[model samples]
Target: MNARTGPLSDVRILDLTQALAGPFCTMLLADLGADVIKVEPPGGDMSRTMGPHPNDRAGTDYGGYFASVNRNKRSVVLDIKTDGGREAIFKLAATADAVVENAKTGVMDRAGIGYDRLRKIKPSLVYAAIRGFGDPRTGRSPYADWPAYDIVAQSMGGLVSITGPAGSDGFRAGPGVGDIYPGTLAALGVVSAIHAARRTGHGQFLDVAMYDAILTLCENIVYTYSRAGVVRGPQGNGTPVLCPFDVFRSRDGAVAIAAPGENHWAILCNAIGRPELIADDRCRNNPKRVANAEFVREAVSAWTTAHTTQEIVAAIGGRVPVGPVNTAKDIFADPHPRARGMLIEVDQPGDNPPLTIAGCPIKFTETPSGIYARAPLLGEHTEQILAEAGITDASKEKS
Candidate 1:
């Protein structure tokens, strides 16, 4: 294992999570130097089979989906339903600072390894859960028993209601923000609870609901409805409150431009060779420009459509806020990601070439965080982990 060196180096986390949301939360902790032990079932994580595998590594144990989020962790297989498995978990929990999982409400409790059971062995163990709704221990929801995924959370949480073009049903975001955001919140909760446990000699149970996370992401709509009694729908790429704050067609591609502030608006007008519009009543202030958004959009579009994205950026890049729409290819070619160490290259299983995954965004000067190791194979460290925890008979459950 790579030498752990970061803010969380001293923390030990028992990661009983699979799939994106739970894994994502633990990934953050692992990246920050936490000793995250990923406890997998007999069949391994379902995402192990969810792939975009390297063409040459068809028999690889996991694919991009699993590797991306499970990096920097050790894997140990255990059948928690068995008495030996349950004993192994209890032993691990006795030394763990936290335990994280994303199963449905009662799944862990039914298996006899839930927070209530583990807290008895280690009272200072922080137990964090991520569920579609929320755990009943915190608050019960009518849909607590219902299963949910990213799309379901987005739709029910109001995100899909305010996305995409106006006049049509909104679109789901391309990425799984529903799972990711909840996972992020759960990670935060685990860390905070661990800190409290250290000081107070007590641990607690916490949970993050995917639905609640998406609702928080779309917080603007709630205040809008409550304050103005306005049910805001999708405004497309441009918002209703800002003028000239939208993507415009450039000669080669599209570029986003925001000029809601007076100075920025003036700078934008000058860059587009339309300085006279700065003093025009219809476009002078932000509100007036928003009221005449169509005209303003057309004027900005007319100028943008004539210039290449690069040219437009060069004209007002520093003076105003602007960025060209970047695709995966563009991002790979960009220097920023490379300079900031956002793209990480890691070895793949088999004889395949190394692959690049996203790097940790969190940066600390004294103790830097990074991808020190690749994702572990299923049960890769089962023997080592079990031995370290003094678990002997649990090895019989591994298949």
Candidate 2:
């Protein structure tokens, strides 16, 4: 019944990241039951102060942003700038399965705790890094030293170029996929490297660049530009290739309708009481329908606009792919998330009421993963973690 009993139960990771990318990667590892020891500098991760703090919990521990991404892990503060701190991290790294960081290219190297240095202590240590551009260990980029955030990656990696309304100047995505995607890829790289290390007893330096990861996420653009000589632009709610795969208006709110396949198309036509559109030459196949997108869009819009979102769902919920565009309130009220264990309620100290955070999406029947503990207060587990690492007298180290 222990929460920290999963696939990565025996693995240990030294997390030396601040802000989004690195913390997110290690957070995933922690979620999988890895002993992720978050190594924060003296002042702690910059994200600790990035607020959206609950009104009742003002000036109490870390803010929501830090809490959200850093659950199920231990925190230990160390001044990597100091000789004592450097010695402590190397000692911890020697006993760790992997080390993860997301600072700019040479930040860790400048601190004397880079991949090369850690590998010297534990030859089989998986040193994973998430960077804005990339590390030279894995093909350096010209912009390796440049600092970047979500917006920069989205714009530079071709995502923003094809986002937003079709005629608009494109917009950055609401969520920070620029950071999140790279973090996800970094987690994969770390795990993969760990897998390889377990077999070969040799670990290597691996990195996921925000720019590269986003480009990979936008694979369609790469293939289209290469094969079809088309540079895609902002597509709004629908793609140029899918005919009825667009968000449409409803009486109360919006609903997304995707009936691209012939069978689904026929079902949608029937649901909308327009079965004749199925035989219409311009709307026959996917290609023709895509060419006549405006007509298809208008037809679907006509039906959706006449009905409420609930009515639309009732008509074609299972017959074709259709869903109401949900708001925060909608998600909280919906039963699907609750039924699937997607909404996990956790207590936020100092905040009178508990807060619900999204649960782990990766489920396993035999080795399940989940949120076990809330995020730590700054260096909350410092002495305990050091004791576990056999550093009984950690008083000399900053915490």
Candidate 3:
């Protein structure tokens, strides 16, 4: 890949985020060719000790969780508690194009590197902050000061209420959408801010709440609450709005079949050799199907179980919108996913066969994505970043 094009190729980001959301955001920017400097405390970010370790050693610092989101960025350790560390951060910020932080609302301010002060120092900077609930000005909520992880955000953000089985407790999404979604949104805001700063020489505050972002993906709940005056709960795999959208057990594994509109329902009926259902008054239209969803699911499941995942998919995939409930391995083998570069083999510095990680979901024809570097070791670029700041350890040696 003779690559020299990215959406944010020229942008430089000073990343002060930890855990999921902030790191995921910067990873996308890094994918788009930005120079992302990942900052940590003198010891390291706490997530370095997260689970799914590369080495089985009990106290190992390299977790796959950290690796997944922190790729394509350089790490530098600077303790905010110390004057020298704060000075170093200010120096780095002086020349940075954007700063992404996920500290509690006032933590950055306490450290003397809040957005207000930094923006004054460098007017065109993009200052993005991802916090638990929001800035203090946000609407009333009890957990404003309490630190939030993904599950907490999912619960309050309204995603938990409608997920999982119909009678069971609310379940969190399989992936950390609560974390990654906000980070992605914050990164977009950062880019927008960077763009505006480039034109106006003025920096604006960028704040993203995990709860708010997760709610954006749960638009259906708001509609159900408003229009139907109903509180939806764990519908399991089935959607309240569409019939036969649920996952059904198949001979091998499981398959998900959706027949949302009339045409799709008709196509699905035709594929299952049940065109009679197309004329049935109880199943003719979307509302009727939704109302009679249980009957429809059982009927579709009976047909789907007789065939393999591929066979069922072949019968009604594009025509009626159906899919097999594929596991991770299945996804890797799928033809379209491979062609789209959704799974790319990344070589761990010296590891053979390389570790395979998911590629960016977004695509661009002329400006394609390229990820050349792996996640940085702790403080991997401390000296280099300090050097770029035009100050070196030579002065500290005298002290």
Model number with the top TM-score:
1
Candidate 3 structure quality by residue, lDDT tens digits, 1-399? 224367777888999988889899999998887888999986788788885655433333456777777878888888877777777778889878999999887889987988878877888888888887877644545666778989988988999988988898888899998898999999889988888888998888878898889888888889888998998889889887778678988778898877778888888888888999999998988889899988898788888788888888877777877788878888887897779887777655433335567777768887776675777778888888888998668633321
What is the Cα-based TM-score of model 1? Answer: 0.98
Model 2: per-residue Cα lDDT over 28-70, one tens digit each: 9888889899998878899988877767765357877898899
Every model's TM-score:
0.98, 0.97, 0.93
What C-alpha lDDT values do all the predictions have? 0.92, 0.89, 0.81
Ranking by lDDT: 1, 2, 3
Q: Candidate 2: misplaced stretches above 4 Å?
A: 56-59, 394-399
Judging by lDDT, tell me the better candidate of 1 and 3: 1
- Candidate 1 lDDT over 43-104, as tens digits, reads 99999988788776644689899989999999999899888888889999997999999999
10 residues in a row with least lDDT, candidate 1: 390-399
